[model samples]
Target: MIKGIYETHIQVSNLEDAIQFYTQVLGLTIGQLDEARRIAFLYMPGGNKTSMLGLWEQTHDLQTRHFAFHCDKDFILHGATEFLQQNNRHPYNFLNDRSSQPMVFCWMPALAIYFDDPDGNQLEFLALLGGESRADLGVLSYADWLRHTTTA
Candidate 1:
């Protein structure tokens, strides 16, 4: 049985640029590179070899993908937006409301913020919240999630 994701691959327009972005910008460590095949594998920080990301270069008819990275609750709530902004990334929410704020998915009771990679691939930083599930609330700002959880 599958316990968790071990690896995932995405098509990138340029392998080198993608590697640099994931390494220098996102702080992933390079695991291996295949120059002939124009592919690279990267290891997530503190992943301890459990997680890997593959980037394959493809210039024609490329398809983008989405993925989420697990983050600490404090970082997600306090610093994720600012970190993204400082790195010139635009943070968005599931609602696409144009505000750069993390939103809470009441069903999962998880907070998350979304942004796009250079290839327009959607990526998310997410952290689970401690609270009773409130699926009826759908998705809302973190502040609202806090208020409702505390009062209810």
Candidate 2:
């Protein structure tokens, strides 16, 4: 049985760029990097969390994927802004500079602002401290799987 998410893997175009982005911009600590520089691991010391990402040279482009982080809205928003300020790069849609109106999922309890890696893989900083009804959603309580659809 699954307990919790352990780590994640993502492919990047350049190893040094990825390392600089994750460590310098995002403030994630570099746990390890292989001798060949094709694989690297990152960690967020504040959250006791760890994730791995890998990149290798290829002739053709690779499929893009996203990574999301859950935290307080203000923390992630500020983090995104700080990242932009330090790296001298704007958000994919300028979320870091907009103080007038939120263009994305800010109104929702789960705040998700997306940016792209050097390879164009979508990445997100998500916040869940705002407003979601985590109250009375029904879920399966049985030990066994639902074998038949019961109308009654």
Candidate 3:
């Protein structure tokens, strides 16, 4: 019955910093702001104000959270990675592996690149490459995934 994710809320240290990171780095659009409550809503691509990520101000002991934006195109993932790197953001692979580039989760056959926000929130841009259900294949490096997909 659930069709798609509409929204998610996460706490941030400062709303302004969060806004800068999300808007400038991640390229998400702002929807609404509750300055009194110290909260802001960031709308994702194709959101049209429907899909949102709420950022509530929280300073004390903020634990890093993970969230991903589903990229509609493979180039968007790679382009985002480049854009982030140019902005002094370091993209990470599984296990915080910066040495390796963005990887492919063979389980979903999706390409993913991960990075952190100003408040250390782990964020990702994921692009689904195919509609193959093969979780048993596990995660693969970008090159490996490409080779396997091409061969199979």
Candidate 4:
């Protein structure tokens, strides 16, 4: 079996804002400040803590766009609660086909939520359901999507 993800790096529009959201809002531990490299890595929950995220200060427009977090439902609500209480702002807002509530959304077998950083980059948190895991989840082929929509 695979050990875990080494890390996930994301370029941020503003490093300061990203830092605030992660450290203050989400309560993630911070690492060494490498201002010269314009990069910072954030860790996740687990034994080995192999899952980590990296934020890079963006000097230009972001190239790769989407980023996500896999967390528990209670953990997400707790984190989102703290985020709103701290910043007076909700993270997840439905860009399209979204509801008008904060920290609440549905997607497949995963309960998903979303929000943005100061630079307007989209962020997501997905709470996997019981007996469900991302291991079985993966890129969908066009044929699969077509079959899924059929009224059989």
Off by over 4 Å in 1: none
lDDT of 2 by residue, 65-104 (tens): 8777655656654566566555765454324454412133
Misplaced by over 4 Å in model 3 are none
How well does each candidate superpose onto the true structure, as a TM-score? 0.95, 0.64, 0.88, 0.65
C-alpha lDDT of all candidate models, in order: 0.92, 0.56, 0.80, 0.60
Task: Estimate, for each residue in 1-152, the C-alpha lDDT of model 4 and write its tens digit.
Answer: 98756777778877877888887766666765688887888776444556777889987977556677777677654565465546755554444334423322222445555666666666777665443223343423223423433532
For candidate 4, the per-residue lDDT at 111 reads 51
Q: Indicate whether candidate 1 or candidate 3 has the larger TM-score.
A: 1
Clashing pairs in 1: none
Ranking by TM-score: 1, 3, 4, 2
After superposing all C-alphas onto the true structure, candidate 3 shows an RMSD in angstroms of 1.9
Using lDDT, give the best candidate's number. 1
Sorted by lDDT (best first), the order is 1, 3, 4, 2
Top model number, TM-score: 1
Which residue pairs in candidate 2 have backbone atoms (N, alpha carbon, C) closer than 3 angstroms, thus clashing? none
What's the CA error at residue 38 for candidate 1, in Å?
Answer: 0.9
Q: Against the correct fold, how does model 1 do in TM-score? A: 0.95
Per-residue lDDT over 1-152 for candidate 1, one digit per residue giving the tens place of the 0 to 100 score: 98999999999999999998899888999999999999999999985999999999999999999999989989988998898888888999898889888899999999999998889899999999887899999998989998899999
lDDT of 3: 0.80
